[model samples]
Target: MPCPPAVRPGTPQWARCRAMYTSEETAALLGFSDGGVDEVLINEAHWTMRNLLLEQLDERAQMLTGRHKSLSMVEGVQHDDVDGIAFIGYHAGAGMEGVLAHTYLANSITGVWVNDVRASEGLLNSHVVAEYGVPVVLVTGDDLACEDALGYAPGALKVAVKDHVSRYAAVCRTPTRTAADIRAAAREAAALATRHQPVRGGPFTVELEFDAEHLAMASTVVPGVRRSGERKVAYTSETMYEGIRTFKAVTTIASAAVEEQYG
Candidate 1:
């Protein structure tokens, strides 16, 4: 997952500027091979979901690239054999300070809460994978993102590639330094990959706060979602699988309703 420039004017800039970062991160993860790990599936979860450079990855791993995935960010976790998952190049949630931070909708979403707890994409996806009995073994990101992971996957190994100064600025480590650290951590994290009984931590409640009132109003178009406040909508589901689906639907519908100039 590449971190797009905060003020890039077009896709070309993003492609030229940010794509290499994610590739380097992906390469660092290849060190997991030393821990008796057989395969690695890189799910493209960023904007457009096609940021990772395929040729840059180690040949031993296969990547899942594109969009319209059933599980979205944690797309491959539905498999019964997946013992662990990792959050690579993730950022803090919307309303938090980290580079290119947001939930599903980059600008419209203000906050997301799961079971009355503030959640990032990591937390929400962590709950989703839990239902499938897969542990989140490692998380790599900026300092704040690693701190955020502590709330959901406390026992998982964490690597901070940068230190957040603001949403756009970060004190970054050079690729050589970060890659060495990430590879070593991934090797250690591999030993933590152990599946457990599926967690039925539901019925789950999800609440989303939007940056605009119109976005909240638009979210109600998703059947179960209703306006919970002037700029908030909430929904509940019997399981997190259902919960994430509804959340995706709500973000989709709301994004469509955004007014280009005013939003």
Candidate 2:
């Protein structure tokens, strides 16, 4: 497919963003064709390595290697950078009815909330990026995932590649159809990629519901996280930056606590 001319904002500022899963196709479809600036693809190690070797990529990419980065603990985004972002191949939050639904941990986490609003990864990451002035321009996933996004990035274009029939199954769409729809949406969504002033909404209270009682107890190993119930833990952070990383820690410790045949 031929690339479209770059989309421009009123000012000279360029766009930078992040995405994951099926991101290879999403990245190729967007790249500099949809938005003017380069994209920062966030995928697992294997996909990133494949992207590096294929040369199908347009500008440099990024794989969010965790912890102790020179700038941020996760190399997903940098402050004063990234104008817009997209969530690709995301699903419903844990305990939801979407296909392959789960939060950060596959089965350990049953639910998560930020200030009492039930949060999916889309909502949580949206909060993290808004702090740096980044806007969410596009989101692609199952229909429920798109519905879930309305709460987080209602202004962004949402493309539902499939309709959920169950947690592991959906009335899937043809790749050709989805690709065409996404391409159209991506092209139009480029205009929404402009950056804005950073937002500072502080004192975010994050709570997690685990599948097992032990998982909640394990989460308390992270400082500031405490037992909220037999299977829940809660913590408060002054910023989403701290809140997200702390959430990561809680999930990790909880996952490690899982035992075979006993959750």
Candidate 3:
């Protein structure tokens, strides 16, 4: 997940900027408050789930930082009181064209389909939160990611921080510029956080295509995952909550199966 000067962990231009992105977004949404909103929960969803720099955040907000969260990226959404959620720094699904795009396993997974739909992390997580009546209120990422969100969170405000040029390259905007755009959009997004009825959009099937054949066979060790092709595995669950869990298990298994250098 660390790509040196271009996308390394501490560089402000790459990974560190996401902390600023999330903080500014939080500040913007809360700035609109008239005592209507009280708390802001920022969850770390990036690699290791510890990428966000806590000191950069406003005092009014708290972050969920750690790994092995019960719900993973959408961990905080399980509570009935959560009205809305946002997908920030998300990219296109695996096999799609977007900056640093990949599904859960990053490389082993070449693509994922949720109930016959090509699904990004944003799309998959959106379905998971829908079970709890939390709407996706805003999404911020590269241009392709914004476009990807259109299918899963159509009404949610979208802010593209950069234009995708390739998987590792983008026509990026300065943080100063993008922050302003995100701040404004998030302020507006705060109004759309109202909760709705819980959605039971499932009896879901998840299909994953891997880059290697061995990864496919390895995934089958996870219960319910079966080989669907030479390099693909499929699983079904009654709800997206279960579906996402199974998907995580499959990816973890596939990750372990990948051979170094030759993979």
Per-residue lDDT for 28-142 in model 2, tens only? Answer: 3563265555565554321112222223334465455334432232245555666677676677887777877777777778899889998888888888888888888888889
| Greater-TM-score candidate between 1 and 2 | 1
Best by TM-score: 1
Please identify model 2 stretches exceeding 4 Å from their true place.
Answer: 1-24, 38-74, 261-263
When 1 and 3 are scored with TM-score, the better candidate is 1
Candidate 1: C-alpha lDDT: 0.84
lDDT score of model 2? 0.70
| Candidate 2 lDDT score at position 106 | 71
Q: lDDT of each prediction vs. the true structure?
A: 0.84, 0.70, 0.82
Q: Report RMSD (Å) for each prediction in the order shown.
A: 2.5, 9.8, 2.3
All candidates in order of TM-score, best leading: 1, 3, 2
Tens-digit lDDT track of model 1 for 1-263 = 22445324256767674555665556456767877788788787876777677877778778898989999999888978788888888888988878767887777888999888988999999999999999999998999999999999999999998999887789999887887888888889998888999999999889999988988998898888988899999999999999999988998898888887753
Which is better, 2 or 3, measured by TM-score? 3
Better of 1 and 3 by lDDT: 1
Q: Tell me the TM-score of each prediction against the true structure.
A: 0.93, 0.80, 0.92
lDDT tens digits by residue: candidate 3, 139-232 = 8899999999999999999999899998877898877787677777777887888999999998998999998899899889998889899999
As a whole number from 0 to 100, the lDDT of residue 246 in candidate 3 is 88
Give residue 190's lDDT in candidate 2 (0 to 100).
76
